[model samples]
Target chain A: MLILSRRKDETIIIDDKIEISIVDIKGDQVKLGINAPRSVKIYRKEVYLEIEKENAAAARSSDALASLGDLFKK
Target chain B: MDNDVKQISIPSGLYGFEGLTKFALTRASQEPFLLLKSLEEESLSFILIDPLYFRPDYTPDLSDEDLKEIGEEKENNLYALAIVTVRPGEDPQMTANLQGPIIINGDTLTARQCITSNPKWQTRHDILAEIRSHQGAESC
Candidate 1:
């Protein structure tokens, strides 16, 4: 992992298109401001990983799905 | 038939499977749950549900940046679909991954899964339980 030290309002440019800046820092929480091309998508690393794990788990056979029997009755 | 399949491009793909760009939305055995299948790999597919159908209260906020990312001007154009996780032979229950919903642009047909700002929705939301909860309240 590449770590860089930047104070509030400091910005980092990537590929000359994407710009990430530290908007504010208060105690443990840090606010970031990102400016990138419309094509670029951003997400939290932990949240992305959680979705990926669920996606993989959902990728099961149709037979397995049907064989699971019925959902709980009312 | 080939005409039945809905072709879509996932610019960022789904989390771990970012390499796959071309995908097909095919009908699943279950109603309201479509199969998000990868055209490149026959074995790759996921059960997807429009979370709104089950949880109408769910309206995740879409930022201006997120809208532009998918080439959308209106927030409504970005369709939200939640991935459904099913465990076979044991609990036999289905859960929707509400933490991050997949948003697709109607015009561009490009999709990307994004995290919701609303913390109420979690990674696993029980569909049947939600239905029952709503149904139970309606009786009162």
Candidate 2:
């Protein structure tokens, strides 16, 4: 991992296309502003993980398949 | 064989799976999770699918003009959809997006996922995985 230290208002450029800026800093909290193309998708890590979890959960239930198998077999 | 069984007809268009009789999801320690299952129809097959398989960021593409035609607010109201796959044996197979979650006006069943900003759905999910799981279970 490439780690760098910078103060507020400072910016970092990635691949010449994406930019990350430190917008504000408070005790134990820092706000970041990201500048990326529309093609780039940005999502909170927690939100993404939550969605994935729900999708997997909904799929695991066997009620749908059990009913279908019974239908076709008869 | 008696010929008194009534034939059921499933609509050709996409439909929401509000009450599927059976469905299951499989978790692989190293591989992607799989959803598989069957429906209540005798000749119809339902495939359990993971929404992530279709679109990582599944947003409906809609223009401002399109929203006006339906009298819908762009940000406040949008449609989502999911796809489901069905088959009737080793012949022709059909798949539907069970993600996107086709949004419809509560008052009207007219539905479409052609546009929306929701990114929590998928376009395609496989069915064969579910069949294998069920078959494997029955053998044991």
Candidate 2: tens digits of C-alpha lDDT, residues B2-41: 1222122212222333343332223322122233223353
lDDT of each: 0.77, 0.43
Model 2, range A1-74, lDDT digits (tens) per residue?
99999999999999899999999999989999999876555655654344344334444332244444443343
Shift in Å, residue B117, candidate 2: 5.7
Q: Report backbone clashes per prediction.
A: 0, 35
Best by lDDT: 1
Q: Write down the worst ten-residue block by lDDT for model 2 chain A.
A: A54-63
TM-score for each prediction?
0.75, 0.37
Q: How many residue pairs clash in model 2?
A: 35
Residue A4 of model 1 has an lDDT of: 95
Worst 10 residues of 1 chain B by lDDT: B67-76
Pick by TM-score: which candidate is best? 1
